[model samples]
Target: MQETRVAVAGTSFPAVRQHLEEMLPGAVVEAVPVELLRSGGCAAEVLVPAMCRIDAAVIDRVDGLRLIHQWGAGLDGVDIEAASRRGVLVANVPAGVGGNAESVAEWCVMAAIAVNRRLPVLQRVLRSGAAWGDPPGRSLHGRTAGIVGLGGIGQALALRLRPFGMRVLGVRRREDAELAGRLGLAWIGGAAQLPELLRQSDCLFLCLPLTEATRRLIDERALALLPAGACVVNAGRGGVVDQAALVRALESGRLGGAALDVFEQEPLDPASPLADRPDVLATPHIAGVTDSSYRGIARRVIENIHRLHDGRPLLDCVNADPAGAQASRDS
Candidate 1:
């Protein structure tokens, strides 16, 4: 029997390889540099695209490529239509499965508070030995928190924010009355009600994935709708918010501050204006990179691999019809 060839794209997160090797002792697991993969130098039966874009070109170049599994929830980089057409199975470990959602939610809470309290300004004040209490901060209590995307992370955030005495307002692709009632949300609406949510919220939380509809969802107009001095905390995809428009809003004093964990570009360029702004608290997309999340993700990946070998259905498959691909391969 030939050993399964598993190629993990990207060099970051060495623990993924470690976990895979420990679980699948007989499999050949190797970390393929993202640069090499982009250059069409990787071939594997199973590919874990860790923060690497898997476009049609890369998909077609690789031989014996059966699966393209993302290490975590974000699959925006993968060209799903092309993968489906090529009979390649694409799957992802959804948020909340392995404490990823909770971890990200925790980060969002911290960020909201940090921005509200003018943490960066305080830090600078302390560093410069400035007068104590030079700048005042706002409190989270009794403020309206508008959560866009009501998915796993959004739901987690709502639950966590309840204890902070915040009035939670949620906007999801679809409104779920039961879920809203369960989360004790002040109001829940669909995409169409986003503007209303913005107008009422004291803080805006972007927790949705980046899709065609959601890309630049919070453009200049949307930002303008937000109450003046309202803070923004984004734990979701960076593209969901218009970076340029956000900069304009912040610079003009239309918005209070922003806490951003993800950006339009990973490893945000140091030269970018968003990098050094005192009002902008930036993190390098580490909201969901906790040990518990990775371990849960690794276990799911391993299970799917075993299922593929056993001719069973894959878990969390995003493709329209993965069985079609499996049948094509078998035939």
Candidate 2:
């Protein structure tokens, strides 16, 4: 039997290596650095890409690559079409199993409350030794929260918000009447109802994925629908919301404030206007990245590898190609 080989691209993260080693007892798990991956030095049966570019050029060099298992949920960085053309199966750790949905949910709710309460302005006032009563912060109690994309993170957020005495509204691909009743969503509808949902929301949470249809989904028209002074919290792909339009809305006071964990261009340009705004809270993209989440990701990778080696079906195969997975069966 040929010993299985796996290569990971990123700064050396020991936990992932340890888990991969334990799962594939005698197999080799090489921690390839970004420079090497970009230079086409990694040649392994399986590739684990963690926040590294896996473009078509990089894919062309991996001679016998059978799988491109993502270390996290986001596949935006990967060249899925390139991998598909080469018959390489691409997979990711879905929400419930990875435990990241809960972490993201907490971050979303926290941002919503933090921005609405005007934390920065209040802190600045007290630090400057000025009286604090002039700027008031709003409470989540009795307010309506509109959540777009009722996926794992959205469902988790809806559940978490109930205790705060807020009404939850959701929009997704289809209206799940049953899920709406169980999740206690005040109302659930499809994309057409988004305008109404925005109009009613005091806090709007964008948790949708970035697709061709969803890119810039929340632009000037959508922001204009938001009730004046409404707070926006985005834990989803930044491209989903029009960053330029958002800035204009905030500048004009049409939208109250925003808490953003991800931006259209990451390491968000220092010169950007949103960086220093008191109403905007911008954090590096670390919403779902936690120690626990890393471990969960390792487990998902292990499970998929086992399935691939044993000729069983892989989980969360986004680009479901029979030939890609069947190659592993033949191996």
Give the residue spans of candidate 1 off by over 4 A: 320-331
Q: Which residue pairs collide, candidate 1?
A: none
The most accurate candidate by TM-score is 1
lDDT of 2 by residue, 1-331 (tens): 3488998867645567777787677789988877877776667989988557788887876777889988767788789999988878889886656778888898988888889988878778889999758688899999999999888889999999999999999999887889999999998999889999999999999988778888999999999999999988999888999999999999999888999998898658999988989999888777777777766777888888887877767889887757544755446
Provide TM-scores for the models: 0.93, 0.88
- Per-residue lDDT, model 1, residue 40, is 59
Q: After superposition, how far is residue 224 of candidate 1 from its true place, in Å?
A: 0.9
